[model samples]
Target: MSAMTMLAVGDIVGAEAAAWLAQRLPILRDQYEIDWVMVNAENCSVTGSSPIDGFGMTTEVVDMLLTAGVDAITGGNHSWDGPDVDKVLAYPQVVRPINVSEARGQGLVTLDGAGRTLTVINMLSPTAALPGMRAPQPKPLWPSWTELAASTSLPGAIVVDLHGESPWEKASFATALDGRVSAVLGTHTHDASLRGHILPAGTGYIADLGMTGRLGFSGGGFDPAYFAAQLRGDNPHKLPAYRLATGRMTLGALLLRLDASGHTKAITRVS
Candidate 1:
């Protein structure tokens, strides 16, 4: 039996949090002996209300993850913040799936490491946030997940990063794939959920992994005055910009002890 110490972190906003994580995550890994770490980098770049990154910070974000020894990455609506992100996705080691057609990255890949072959799949759910996009559409992401789980092409375990906004969707999908996948972790909403637990069939699950970057602020990283101005319907206030604290930023993950059959014997969410 091999223990799969997988860390599925929340959405990371910008480089500042990355800096913080570089120092903090290793400590946690040492304390827990984590084997693999994956994070949601949807907001790692500065983008407006769209899914595309306006700023070309995806490369830097990925570099930070690599430096932090993260095994892979998955993102939500903001994965396509900039055109440059497509270039980074071409690296093959990275996984980014678009619910819509013509997305840049692959939704599924296999990782062989730590005496096990782990298959990691990334998917997006069609919730209210994703307009004009259909769940399991373009190429049927959810069904693809099931197919991958049932495939014999890959050995070892399976880890899925469900990037979506709806807790219901995440939970429902997780239940559907239970016993097939080793772990089902969710991202987006910037707030961690209390729904993570080991199922009777040994599948690990969570509603969301929470946010890694600035949070509890009105805007992504704006100061109080600027946030207030925007709230008051005032014209763009030119006051000094503020980089909100990462908040009582919590890093969450499902630690599972899976046997050779990809069955989780025990699962725990590191507080």
Candidate 2:
């Protein structure tokens, strides 16, 4: 049976990270013989001049990634960060969280990759420490995703990017979608999950794909010292300005192999 490979990238931390990826993604793609590429780009644009924070993706970076051969761009809690983000969301190939808002943008995208049709969905759990979400998490996955699948003329191999906080919750969600989707990949936490494996029902599952930014910091690519001061409730005045860590950029993602029917044949890390 013929098969194709997809590279699902982890959270990108900043514009530099995006630019860095645009330069080297082709090498990674060639190295893996990858057919399609998807990225969790919510953090591609960092906001705030003081007490800085990860917000949403920017247009330039998104365009850079797309030019670098990224087939799909997925968003998380940061999807609604600002008007600039709205422009990013409106990109034809971008997929925002389905439950967030239908009027905002599409929740999934169907693309032809390597001569095969593929469906990609981006989902964000409401209770995931998102800035504006309410106390109770808004879960529209079960019936909602199933409903969307039923209504759309989707290809057999569907991949879901479940951006959530809790690991077990992500696992359970993937389990529920096990036999139906081709793969369920988790993001949000920057660390790579060691559990990349094919489920009994033929779906590929991984707790997280990790980050495509600098590693070894408490907050993945941010100033850990500043983050610690905030956590300790130190005087905001005394803390240094927050900034992205300076280091060698790294690529974090997964290489998934699937057949025409969307059954995962192999799963491995691409870092």
Candidate 3:
């Protein structure tokens, strides 16, 4: 194919947002003539097993996304949160962060669609760590990109979800790989950055893609109380149970147009 369009979505908050996305994503795909779709679903399972249904890529959620036209699913810092993460990691269509030493499954998955093949890479930032982590932030154990790239034969248009915190590290990483891959989209920050642009060498870059969920201060997933208490130096154990924010659904995404050689010709913000 001379040109292909790939939709890279930001982190999803809860089941409500996931289901809603399933219903409407196909329409967007059709509208853009999208050849591939990748979504960050680390937060998708944060709510646990509830009436709304939650946990890392539940079987039902996987089915919904698959049937709804999603080609690949990527994860974030919450990759190893619960037993659910293990389950999703086994599915060919789902992937967790590759940089995590102990993350359950492969960080990269090859997706065949739109009359061509594409490789979806999911990896964490050395600076992005959650309470679930056994190590500290900016951990030095992260493997170098040169080493990672040398280890694999990226045969198709490569789209990477560089899930991380530091804008410098993420941007530098993407910059170093310019022309070697299609796009390196950042996630983890729930607020989208306005820096979506193609690198001088042709790889598309963005600091953060925000999120696809309810519009709110607490990532549209939880009520403001939890984040407020945490910021006030309140004891985390004493914080009230997280309250789900019920607000208007919103989408944060980027549309990448890649040429036959896998260099992104354009990176358009589609939020």
TM-score of each: 0.79, 0.90, 0.89
RMSD after Cα superposition, model 1 = 4.3
Judging by TM-score, tell me the better candidate of 1 and 2: 2
**Angstrom error at residue 250, model 3:** 0.8
Tens-place lDDT digits, model 3, residues 1-271: 4578889889887778889899989899999999888898877755453212233456667677888988888876666555565577788888877765654577788877555778998877766765546322323423545566878787688888988888887888888788888888999876788768889878989999878889865554557676677779998669866656777888888898988878888888886
Candidate 2 off by > 4 Å: 50-54, 129-138, 235-240
Off by over 4 Å in 3: 48-55, 134-142, 217-220
Model 1 lowest lDDT segment of ten: 47-56
* Ranking of all predicted structures according to lDDT, beginning with the best and ending with the worst: 2, 3, 1
Error of model 1, residue 209, in angstroms: 1.0
Candidate 1, after superposition: displacement of residue 260 in Å?
3.7
In model 3, pairs of residues that clash are 45-55
Candidate 3 positional error at 127, Å: 1.9
Off by over 4 Å in 1: 47-57, 98-100, 132-141, 146-154, 217-248, 252-254
lDDT of 2: 0.79
Q: In candidate 2, which residue pairs clash?
A: none
- In model 2, the worst 10-residue window by lDDT is 129-138
